[model samples]
Target: MPHLNLTRALTAGVLTLVASQALAHGDVAPQAVDTTGLPAIEGDWLTENPYRAEKVGEETWQRAIEIGASGYNQNCARCHGLEVVSGGLAPDLRFLEAEEYGDEWYVERFREGYTQNGITKMPAFGELLGQEAAWAIRTYIEARPDEGALDDFAEELKAMRDQMEGYIADASGADTEALKTRLTEISAQIETASGAPVADSVAYRAANLIDGSAEAFKSASEVLTIGLSAAH
Candidate 1:
């Protein structure tokens, strides 16, 4: 009976070790990112991010962020950390610059992945994940605020929030174009102040006008809330 008990203990220990390793490297398998909601990129993958809010429109950019967040959580958070905050196992993706300088390296690394000796560090995700999902992840990463990136924009974000709220409160027969314009301006200011891509929450909401109705104002108001909270 003592011998039998020892055998069971050894088995249990092995099983536990295997389980932990699996959990740690579960992202090794390719996870599917749903890019059906996003606009399809034609031809081969572009070397740069085409989903920037200014380039692809805010709604599309927002959709990309949504998909990218899920993709990153599934495939990247294991090493990259949640919300792009790294715990030192990998580089903090949030600090990646939003301009071409960052884009060049990101595209290359994503396409080829990183391998040290015979060990694969980062798996190549371009072909399996597709450009839409990759770009979406990039968009999400670029939008993450660096340390102190939004400090100077706190008061401005608050002011923008107030303006959006006022619009929502008195939205009856409000000029949709004017509201969109104001929100767009605010988004630009956010990008300029942070020196990073505008957060999808702000970019998407600011650009979309839902038929000039109260619903539109409500949506814009919600965007403001999310953007302000993120900035703060």
Candidate 2:
């Protein structure tokens, strides 16, 4: 058999095995989660079943937490983080708790995927992973700590933005010729400090928005802004 044909046959065989396993079991029960009443999961069971925390379960809570931890590592660790710290490709799942959004909010997000406010990177996993498994992952992740590094970076970036805004206001209000000279000098300084392509660094990118032609710059700014927002 040809290599391509062999590869295809192997793929089909593995999928067939998975399908058989799925079909062998009766459908898993849908878990009932009470969003309004509970505090965050803190590495302990909020209920008898930690994984399906809101539902009544025969399984011990520790066993459920274990299943949930394993399930999250398998399905979510890639884009989110190894320990729910966030890899910068997606929003930190920890935000679900710190932001004080409920389990139902997290569950609905996983099931429906976020589309409002122009955010769409998170695709719905409802079809691929059933409801119980999805909720289990959410329950597990709720206990992880906030990734502190990101908060530090956010503060630094905010300071930079404030500085940039001050410079812009000064330049805009002052003498036209002198303002142009100062902006040029500021742009050059930013380019040097950034250590990356001007277009890539946040400071230079924002500086470029100030200096650039209205039409071209605004479009680029929007794209970059949206990309950065999606990452967080």
The CA lDDT of each predicted structure is 0.66, 0.43
Candidates in order, TM-scores: namely 0.61, 0.36
Query: What is candidate 2's CA lDDT for residue 150?
Result: 28
RMSD of 2: 19.5
RMSD of model 1 against the true structure: 12.5
Q: Give the best candidate by lDDT.
A: 1
- Candidate 1 worst ten-residue window by lDDT: 1-10
Best by TM-score: 1
lDDT of 1 by residue, 50-83 (tens): 9888998877877888888898898888876776
Candidate 1: residue pairs that collide:
none
What's model 2's lDDT at 213? 36
